[model samples]
Target: MGTRLVPSGRTATRLLQAAIGVVLVEGLLLQNPGVVVNALLSLGVTFLPPVLARDWEVRLDTRLTLYIAVAVFLHSVGMLGFYESVWWYDHLTHTLSATVVAGVGYATAKAFDEHSDAVHFPGSFLALYVLLFTLALGVFWEVLEFGARLLATAVGMDPILFQYGIDDTLLDLVFNTAGAVLVALFGSGALRPLVESLTTRFDRSFGER
Candidate 1:
């Protein structure tokens, strides 16, 4: 079966939350309150897009919301120890993170155009920008992970709390690129609608320009 390019509707959102809920429960059982906190923070980010609801152009749509939800859910599960048990969990989360951030970048650019009435980028150019933006963010994320690992060691916590081995790090980058390219290629159809229409415009306002 073909994978759903973008998950639509509220049902998908609920499923994402449910999955995370399961992971969160597991974390609680394991007596790791920090894991629960991380889970909540992740969920909070997923829901934060609505704060921009006053501007319809940049408001997160169902697809982007679901993307963020899934990425966070996967990461939460990994935090709760599923990444080691399930094996594919970390790979999937990295790939999903790349795609999610790139989609958000694309939507933000489109929203800026609506506000500034500036010249708009064509679909491909927008996709490239999103791809690069996502990759840069992904790299920065890895850096944070590195820093977390160091801090953990300094404090006598798990030195690998946020760090992965070189192979895992390289794999994450590779998966990130794969996800970015997928969005850059298929995003016009799959990712664009996550940006809601401005008051007077079509669902997309750039195709004719």
Candidate 2:
């Protein structure tokens, strides 16, 4: 089953990567700076999984790679007018992005707990940490969107990031919490090996220093 999924995951990732490139080209041709910037950023993010696997010698699951690619690809696509055109698109992207954020929080906490003998985190604490960390990031993102809109307005240009309203911000946080809770509950098993690999690399790097 793992082998079968690996091929399919790789195929999906490749397709998403190609789609991102198409979006980049579209943005370039359309002379849309916002879309082009988003596509470029998303392109960089979609490559991080493979880059981390190669550089850190971490054997990341292909599903994780595909997951990251899908999140960024969807965001880049959303920048092409789907946020305003399709109502649910923003929520979907927010949920997906929140999952990624939660994963990062979980990985960092696990890595620290494993790497430092004095710093220990209980399972319950880890879950709380992930939830809080995700919410904090969600808030920060909303702030960024608001700032972008303000700056764009001052300059008389359309904002690259939009803040819908108080309601949408609250909903985004709710979905962010939902994503974080899922990772807290079920992410440990899937993320364990990656965390171990990262801890090992950190140990080696610190020891060498």
Candidate 3:
């Protein structure tokens, strides 16, 4: 895999990509330009670190990143169309959507990596890891939404409040945790080996061997 670094050119390229994403969201996707821009900006910030630190295996990570980008973009499109007015509740729903997407993305990446023999972590351990990671990410996303509200308020933009009550946030955490745990538990057993065998076969057929 190539080294992950925030090369100046790459950063510029990412920004350009983000700009193009904004255009697509606004045009083809029929989302508000402002909403699309906001979502893309957030996405760019989230992805920048991985691109710079290059901590993840590229083959799997690239797919994970794309999944996240598309999910977030679609979530933003939905919010813009449905909400029309940004409320705290709207923000909370958006956060929920983002968290769910991210959790699924991580699980998918782990599954693919295991199939490809690109990485290995014990199934039991991976289950715990996924649970913990999902919970941590839930908290992290809340913090991000809070920060976004603050930034918007500071700039005299409409303040998006946390519409979901504290109880709702807790519920979201529970659901997010459940989703990851379920995937890890079911996926790590018979599914992992089967997937690996299939992937091997497919790769062999295509002269990847």
Name the candidate that leads on TM-score. Answer: 2
What TM-score, computed on C-alpha atoms, does each candidate reach?
Answer: 0.76, 0.90, 0.48
Global Cα lDDT for candidate 2: 0.85
Which 10 successive residues of model 2 have the least lDDT summed? 1-10
Weakest lDDT window of 10 consecutive positions for candidate 1: 1-10
* Model 3 alpha-carbon drift over 4 Å, by segment: 1-34, 41-57, 61-70, 81-121, 159-163, 187-209
Local accuracy by lDDT, each model: 0.69, 0.85, 0.51
Per-residue accuracy of model 1 over 1-209 as CA lDDT, tens digit each: 01222445567877777777776787678767657766777777656656544444345555666667777877776786777777788888888888877766776676556545446777777877887898899888888788878887788765334657788888888888888888777775664455434422432454433
Ranking by TM-score: 2, 1, 3
TM-score of 3: 0.48
Task: Between candidates 1 and 3, name the one with more favorable TM-score.
Answer: 1
How big is the positional error of residue 207 in model 3, measured in Å on the Cα after superposition?
26
Clashing pairs in 2: none
Residues 6-110, model 2: lDDT tens digits:
666878877998999999999889888788889999989877766776777655566776788889999999998999899889889988899889998898789
lDDT of 3 by residue, 62-116 (tens): 3333434544554554445444454343444544454444445444545455455
Candidate 3 lDDT at 44 equals: 67
